[model samples]
Target chain A: MQSENSSVNTEAKKIQTSKVPPSEGFREAFLLHLADTTLILTQRNGAWCGHGPILEQDIAITNITLDLIGQSRNFYQYAAKLINESSLAPSPVEKAGDEATEDSLAYLRTEREFKNLLLVEQENGDWAQTIVRQFLFSVYQYFLFEQLQNSKDDQLAAIAAKSLKEVTYHVSWSADWVIRLGDGTDESNERMQKAIAALWPYTGEMFMQADYEQGIISEIHLLKDRWIEKVKTVFEEATLAIPENIFMQSGGKNGVHTEKLGHILAEMQYLQRTNLGAKW
Target chain B: MQNINTDFKTNPINNKASQVPPEERFREAVFSLLEQVPDPEVPVLSILDLGIVRDVKVIDDKVEIIITPTYSGCPAMDAISMDIRFKLIEYGYKNIKITQVLTPVWTTDWMTENGKKKLLEYGIAPPKRSTNNEDEMPKCPQCKSANTKLLSQFGSTACKALYQCNDCKEPFDYFKCH
Candidate 1:
């Protein structure tokens, strides 16, 4: 009787361990993805701080960048919390047991760990190109956040709800500029078309959901596909044609980004890396 | 009894009309004086008019003013904070504390009815509540027309957007709902 009870107890333990769900790790990865995109884009937009095409536009773009930075901070903070709770290990391990705080997680991560899409890191080309890039990105972001507001995760839903309002304005602003440049004069329209053609390749990366996103969708019931449909509808209304070129480029999700990201990181991490433990 | 009478008689009303405690009067004065501080973005509107000032408190001979920024990242927030400090100092309040409250997030819904009326009169559309339902349309500030179209979501400031009135053919700025 004692031997049989011991065997049964061992079997129960095995089943209990096996029954535990696999670590979704979705929330952590999603937060990092959002943070990387916002942080990099904020840095790019910050370059236009003093040198906008016009005074009003300069102020507008800078203001938008500030909003992005604020959003990035909030998202990164939430991501840090998620990371602390998740069982997933950090990639390209360097320092073991070095707990990452929100600030450290944002500032300390190496280049390969970032998961931003390549488009956000692309060079700002010219003023027209920048507007087009922003327009395209904002439209997608607005739609994405709109759907994300209903996410089962309360924190993510709250962030999405707040950011959706801001993204709506951002999209509208970019859309206006797109239409103005697209429908304006021969030179303006030509430039607008050129910008669109240049940025067309990067659009595919925004919609590509990988295993991390898929896991989250299955576990948390997140609405990732809905965001894509909403984006498509907006694109249709904007009188813009979706690029049919099936040859898509994607690497940012895997932390393989363009060369520009290296330089961006150098600038962003200089102070933090050089002066470790320094407080402003 | 003699001491209590002395205290009551020492009240400003008994000694001189202007010698009252000045707590209530000072608060009223500060309210009016601060009303002159215009919103950095929309100069035509006062900070009080926009409802950014949340509370005014006086305790232990110190003045505490609470304010909320229109947007979290608004550059105007720093300017507004500085402006409040300077204005209070200028008003002879030696110990003034300006506290910023970030929760409850500032929304255009805080704007006074008169403030909204003024915004429309100034050709700027007042903000409308954001709705998840799909049937709502933003009205134009100039013509009060529902036929207006959103020209762009981004406006001159983080808090506004550019919209065009189809009826009047005028382009106006819409104060965005936070």
Candidate 2:
């Protein structure tokens, strides 16, 4: 792994010297939204790596984390290229002497510049909360990836097509847990209900359109009802009640985030920040 | 039909000539050489057996191999790609290129019949064909019993499921078909 990190030094330098003008469009923001959301959530999910309720469950969650992070790597790599080819942002486009490698884009960005969802940034409180958060996000991702798989953009379509299968498994696995714990003992049911109430407010932002999503508005709107229907089915099967008429939290898509995101970045980026350009 | 026969009779050697184009012959040679490269995870199965090798092209004496990973985070892909390059180099093929494609996402259904047989023989149950019931339990490769229960949705790797046979009381891995 150390050798692998060092091996990219040459390519990284080449990327820096090739000063391609940033591509102009909403695509860079859209790609960052996908990449940041997954990357931030991956760090949060990594908190559960060795602390799962059981060995198998721990392994399962860790695998989920790996999958999410891998997906983020793909998005970040694509986003970095788009950022290089265009002049779109205050982020990933670095100051003098600094190049925006995927690692730099991920580790060096400030919290104010990140465009992830608040729901993913919120702390993983408990196993129930974690499961609930995963379920809600996976439901949205399922719908999003379904449409993305057929995207006119070939690279996005290819990435989505590969990621869709893995995310499908994530949806099923998390939904199964939701159903089991929701219908289990009274204590477990109570916890699941609480997690749902706390997390439901953040889910609304998933459907709320960001400026970058303007191009995909109608495409996203087409899948909104299906996402709702899918979540509704799982909640019903889980014997959990849904909260209605509640306010939904927003603004994470616009670079505003919960305070939790800063702490997550502090911890996840600590090594990279402290040891700048250090391999492995 | 008469025209076709007459054409063949006029240049009878043409059947042998056109049947194997130079490109096709080179492709066959590349495939045969690639067969020596086994999957990083399941060393018994070749990349062809794992269905990751999507295409093998030889153009102007240069070789290009196309591959797809089983999963997005599959750790074996990098190793497998490196192994392919190394083996090709060892086989004296210069100017080798390995391209990774994600479109038309890979499925376990692409695993060859011989691959499945090898997996079962190696004590790993191959993924079953797509069925409406996702909960369908795979037969235990150890005891050939259908009364196996899933121990974990995830196993040693992302692409496998852990199962334990009730009768034989043995744990095994099932290569989950995506």
Candidate 3:
């Protein structure tokens, strides 16, 4: 049930007139993965816009927030197009209609419909926690975008290529903070350790391939290895210990998220839900 | 928009309609025309100077121009594409198409030396050539002093950084290297 990477080899053809098409399902899932991850992470980062430790840092985090939202908007637009064009069965949390749009997809969807990684949706704890979360996610995303730049889907590839540059900066910025905080004062080091313990389990969910991504599961694993290597270097420099063989949290990709996600969705969707279709 | 400017339209340099010499000549004309399209945010640099114009193709009377965006969230790209279209239309070109490509991905390396100079002259420091040199401090555009410190990683926009000169004590924007 592998969906063909149409941009790569057009010669390979398959005929499956029966059963729900894998391509349709995979596309819906994958696009949601893109949109939800970016949207949630944007919201998380946006929380620090005016509240960063310093004036410059506030503006820096806000810029990253805007970039994440911009990337999510593109993904949501593409997802809406896919859903609109196909007769794919809607998930329980999704409502397909003629009014499908990026805004509707983002603001109208229920909590259970989102497919973001759990790491992003968790509460932006302390400054140390936030940086730790950002560092881990940005490193994974940098590798993800690099691989996705060669996607058979030209539009996705374009989006990936454009976003890769932004995420590269995010990784570097967050990694620097990680080193500073991890190897800094005793209090900073303790907080960094606690942040790592809280966030490490969520990292596992990022590598778990969805049904649509089954074809590229091995590729993702390779990227996961690269992510690990990159993180290993940062940890070595920061004097932080890498967690191993622990029980990893799961289910965010399947629209099942922790309590933090529900609260986030409430705040994010409130304006849109209350003032339906209000335009700025 | 300005009375069609018939004289400007007929001028070979302005209109680019001097009987097509070759396909290459037509492309050259289009490139020269696009050189007039400046970035909306950084007006000192033309889209061509910024290395955003990827390619220009002429098929019979139809023209296709390809451009790439510097950032995923760059709002200026919409304005830039519109500016290209209007500028070409003002020159009397018909059936013009603008396509955006993102394959090779944009880097500050694509920005022309001239563009970098313009950025500096405009009081904003240009990005360094290398992406990995994030730790290296950029010299102040106003003072030309490397004693500047980064006040913020983000600036007025996503592409620049906020910095202040230690020598001249002047605050400025540094166009971050992507």
**DockQ of each two-chain model:** 0.18, 0.29, 0.37
What is the per-residue lDDT of model 1 for residues B91-117, given as tens digits with 9 covering 90 to 100? 666666677654445667788888888
Q: In candidate 3, what are the lDDT values of residues A109-175, reduced to their tens digit?
A: 8878888999999879999999999999999989887777766666777788889889988987899
- Candidate 1, pairs of clashing residues: A169-B153, A172-B152, A172-B153, A173-B152, A173-B153, A173-B154
lDDT of 1 by residue, A172-201 (tens): 667767776666778887777777778777
Cα displacement (Å) at residue B52, model 1:
6.1
Per-prediction TM-score, please? 0.65, 0.87, 0.81
User: In candidate 2 chain B, what residue range of length 10 has the lowest lDDT sum?
Assistant: B1-10
Q: Give the per-residue lDDT digits (tens) of candidate 2, residues B52-95.
A: 99998766666778888888778787888788878766766666
In model 1 chain B, the worst 10-residue window by lDDT is B1-10
What ranges in model 3 sit over 4 Å off? A1-24, A90-96, A243-245, A274-276, B1-17, B21-37, B56-65, B85-98, B131-137, B146-152, B163-171
Candidate 1 reaches a DockQ of 0.18
- Alpha-carbon runs more than 4 Å astray in model 2: A1-23, A87-93, A97-99, A219-221, B1-23, B131-135
